[model samples]
Target: MDLATLMSKGLVGPLTAPPAREASFPYGLDKHGLHEIAEAAYGDRAAATGFLLAAAPRPPRRTILLWVTQASTARDMGRVPEAALREATGGKARRLSLVTRHATDALWAVEEAVVSGVVSHVIAEVDSADFTATRRLTLASERHGVPVTLLLPHICEGATAATTRWRVGPQPSAPNRYDPRAPGHARWRVHLERCRAAPALVGQAFDLEWNDETLSLNMVPGMVTGSPAPGEAPPHPGFPNRRTG
Candidate 1:
């Protein structure tokens, strides 16, 4: 049996409790198959766009990002703007062919990519969705082994096919460990609204700290459990110097 199971059974001696698991989005923008970012904070589309542009991954070809955007969006939240998407992917986005359509069209495209076996990833930004669409996409994504990420507006409702749903928001910058007063690049609070991959981590909140130098997020560990008490005393030769009456 594993160490954890043995400890729980009282078979092992003293043991320390496991660390609390914290939810973090360290896989960059692509970790969750998200190709579009929402401007939930600052109300500026540029901020979200800029963040994504600076975080897109680079690797071998064979991945497809289906950007679906609304034609009526004022801030261009429907799909990652071509310019911004291009910048984020370091011009690789230029090869992406956008299928401009309504929310329903976008959802259908995701399913198509999943079954086609040509696209490795699919991203859809929609206004409103229902349970049926999400259900179909979920099955398609699983069967085809392709990752599909949905970017919804503030009023997103209904069901979803995503493995995890997150509410990402900007957080106050963490103080620099080296300079104490200097401000860090940026920080975010990612609330795991849903997680099918790891149910045990559901409802867990993570305080993510971003490092600009390494362009990565290092999770801040919290609530470390103390060591358990020993069952028996250790052997010793010492004796009391004084005795009570």
Candidate 2:
């Protein structure tokens, strides 16, 4: 079934045939699936990169990062740079081998890796992608039982071969229970723009709070709904005002 339509109707499940593949792990990252990451804030690409790095899985086998840059630029693709990855993984990026290339070569390399069956996960940061390329990768990744994640820039729109497309935008600060004066790591309001695998989760904008300690994300339910403790204020700016006289 088409992901966009299924997600719109709230009928979410596994994308492929009924094997009940895992959609998401304990961490907020999807499993055996594809998800989109957009700017949390207007231009906070670094935050987006951090979110992905935090969520990236480091398998014992291999985690391939195909960092794609402009066709002509000699500059580095700083989205998932070595330094940032090192910080995110606590200096364990040595576990993950890296590949940097221009978009043209990167696309071909991704296809090659999908068919090789040697890597556990493939992550690509590309300038743009069409449905055909996405579909090709999707099929190959599924056949190889390897998950693929596409990291596109702000202009990531139109059709895709991904299982779910999420518009991850920044949210208001998460009140630090322990340190009232300090901001928590980060929080995101994820709009499940499309969900081919688990369509029931589509249109279900999950307010996710990431815990750096556990390296996992949990669904913060109260942010969307007005339900809160008695005499307590509703959290988040988008929630309705609880101050009924």
Candidate 3:
């Protein structure tokens, strides 16, 4: 065929390809967004809190972190220890604690903190949040470029506008390498109930260990059982205990 004829025929169009999507373990939680971590059980609030502290992205030095807690949640779960916060953030960040009388007030404080543009991060412990409340927080977080993490009770359900929702519970602690009798790294079972950033990852569960020494959250294939006796052989790694939904 003549070149002019082929050109006129429009044999081919410009090649095009869709952009590849980037994925993170906790989805966009470490980034600038509004995410929720809910307890898998009545007493799993502590586990959810620990997971938040371990998994949240560390902020810049001397930055402020506004931690807002509802009165009920504070009374039930207690406040996070200073030493734990120091280890979690490497003592580079400061925390400003706020106690709200009600969930609505707590949510309001969280959104205000995000919009104020003063704190580097925000963590709020509330009874629950509906779609409208979460939507407001998400918008504020996006507009201000600050990340907000919500710690919700096990009863949290139904619609939510958060970028991700994680159901967290305590897992068997990893065996201590040096002292078998001592507690090892803290572990948790994290289930992704909802994810806007990576919907495909929803319903997936992970076994995570928080290594204080390394200050990192790591996923493990299996968890070791209880420590061995003085002369007993070391226990082998096996599947973690599974919880029914």
* RMSD in order of candidates: 20.6, 11.0, 12.3
Measured against the true structure, the TM-scores of the candidates, in listed sequence, are 0.60, 0.68, 0.82
TM-score-best of 1 and 2: 2
- Put down candidate 1 lDDT per residue, 1-245, tens digits, no spaces: 99899668644434132212224342323443322344454444434433443444443554456544445443454345566454445455433555555777777767787779676566665665576677666556555555566655655534564556655566556654555445555665555666655667766766555565554655654431122222344455588557779
Model 2 agreement with the true structure over 59-78: per-residue lDDT tens digits: 54434444434433224334
Q: Please tell me which model should have the higher lDDT, number 2 or number 3.
A: 3
lDDT of 1: 0.53
Residue 69 local lDDT, model 1: 49
Stretches > 4 Å off in candidate 2: 1-30, 40-42, 58-77, 81-83, 86-102, 177-179, 223-245
Residue 203 CA displacement from its true place in model 1, Å:
1.5
Clashing pairs in 1: 53-88, 69-78
Candidate models: Cα lDDT each: 0.53, 0.60, 0.84
Per-residue lDDT of 97 in model 1 = 50
Model 1: residue 103 alpha-carbon error in angstroms: 0.7
- Candidate 3 lDDT, tens digit per residue, 56-120? 87866688899999999888889998888998988988999999998999999998899899999
Order of all candidates by TM-score, from best down to worst? 3, 2, 1
